[model samples]
Target: MGIFTRSIVSRKPNESMRLIVTTFFGVVFGFLIGLCFPKLSLTKFSLSTSILTAIDFKYTEYTKLGPSSSTHVSHPVGNNGSSANVTLRKIWVPSNPRGAERLPPGIVRAESDLYLRRLWGKPSEDLTSKPKYLVTFTVGYDQRKNIDAAVKKFSGNFTILLFHYDGRTTEWDEFEWSKKAIHVSVRRQTKWWYAKRFLHPDIVATYDYIFIWDEDLGVEHFNAEEYIKLVKKHGLEISQPGLEPNKGLTWQMTKRRGDREVHKETEEKAGWCNHPHVPPCAAFVEIMAPVFSRDAWRCVWHMIQNDLVHGWGLDFALRKCVEPAHEKIGVVDSQWIVHQSVPSLGNQGESLDGKAPWKGVRERCKKEWSIFQTRFSRAEKAYLKEINSTSR
Candidate 1:
């Protein structure tokens, strides 16, 4: 202490003042740096170098990326044989104009439904009851009696949706249930067309299961509540009530079995099935009465071709939507419906070159089946090629 005092006394007045000012500023600068990075110690030279490097990196990244964007960094080799930087930025999902990154996961509004909401009621109290399941039928006015009977088979828990191909929506109002039901009217359009447009996965996501059915089905022997019970009991994600063995039965797998509650497989004609797990023999249901669990429908909705409205070959490929599909897809034997096989939609087609409208419709169905199979095969091949290359 005595030596420092003597040294300060020996120095010129201006020099002493300069040393005091320099020391004071140096201490203040270090204290401010400490406040900025409390975790980084200034005493350790190695740690200080690391801290400076990190600060430089953050400054460069923030300046380059800017606000309103998030990035995922990846390292890939460039054509010049040097490591290149890749930035994956946020993108807005079509359903949300605000961008998906800003929202919580799974909180998307892409799903919607046919439930009627009142303008005067609070949003939470709008619906007296939220239906757990959905049932849809494509109808012409001629099938009103059958559809009326069919709707009765489903309990109050099911949301009834009717697609009118004959443009007679108001006529269905005669039935008491129609007052509560959702009706979509479009002349000469098929069920698949309505399904693609109206029954979007997001729209029907609230329902536990969905029934896409033919209007001509005789549901006298079928009970939807019981059908849902059997579906859940068997862990069936994709299923249908068994088609009555007596009429309109195309595949043996879907034929009603009297002995069992549910059946997942059937014996097919020789060479009809390459494996027991394949379609026709197993994992199969006719489109007319196919019922899908919510998760299964999401996948199936995407597989429906927009242009191929007939939905002829969809039954064969539906197994793609559910894992271990043979087990997950089955027919509930306890609840069976008779397919009336009415050609109402086919009759809507215009007669061409003196050919019957129905015949042309049948031809179109066959053509669509061929096109779907070819497209599916090509897609599988392309996906496999991409996967193989990625693995390499």
Candidate 2:
């Protein structure tokens, strides 16, 4: 017997070990062969048809085969070829709900071309435009005789508004000749007080330009037409002619050094002394020669203190009003005008004697000074606030 068969038989001489040993050996051998050659064991296994029937099997037909008969299926072309079972879903690809529709590249270029063509044509016939100019002035006792003369010499197509303290009865009666020229008179208690009242109603009227001056100022080599042309050329809002002092006073400055002082004083003080940023030296001499644009007139008219007791504050009033408004106030070098400075009369209560008249005038000046102080302080504060707010 083989050694394996002998061992098995010897282990159980009185027992039925043959079947047990045979089954054990078969299981062990099959496992070893399966690990070594897996395909061989499956190919070797064949069950009878009865063995498949012994197992419980169930099958069911589908009521609906989804998308099986859809349009994507490829029909068999020939008997030799295989047919592909494909189904295409009728899905709606979402529209561009939030996306911008792209415009054609040439649309912008076409629009630009059309715009250029339209703009190239001549403008509409309805458009009407013309140059406008307005003239204005203030007159006092000294200016009464000369107002008509100045007006006649400087008159133009411009509308002239003349303000006078000496009433319509004076030498300004000839101004009535020009319907465009208006003469407004103020109550004649004091020249300074009345001058302030003259500015209100006249300034508010609508005009493209305004020219204010004392009538005593004489035009020398100044062409109003040429001056207006320059004004328009430079786009200046406020302009004054270069003033040569009628008194022919030379300007001189004084200097002080250690242990030595140099003084150059003139009895002839013409107008106010010109500073660097202030009006030019010429403007100072010709106080009556300033010409204002409509905008400047409007701004300056509001700042005038009509109740001011004296005429001393007019320059200060002008500087305050014009400087803050960002309007240009410049001296025209080409034009020239002369100022005829006149002395002030003493107060109504004073006698011509040195004691009474001087005292009364001094008292009046003090009263006017007090009024100026109050008004200037208030105006300055308001002006500063306006400027600061504008800057912000």
My TM-score estimates for the predictions, one after another, are: 0.75, 0.46
Q: Report lDDT (CA) for all predictions.
A: 0.87, 0.50
Tens digits of per-residue lDDT for model 2, 273-318: 4444343221222235556776666666666566655555454345
lDDT of 1 at 377: 94
Clashing pairs in 2: none
Q: Which segments of candidate 2 are over 4 A away from where they belong?
A: 1-134, 137-145, 168-180, 189-198, 201-205, 246-275, 278-287, 322-327, 344-374, 378-392
Clashes counted in candidate 1 amount to 4
Find the candidate with the highest lDDT and give its number. Answer: 1
Worst 10 residues of 2 by lDDT: 108-117
Worst 10 residues of 1 by lDDT: 59-68
Clashing pairs in 1: 111-202, 111-203, 112-202, 112-203
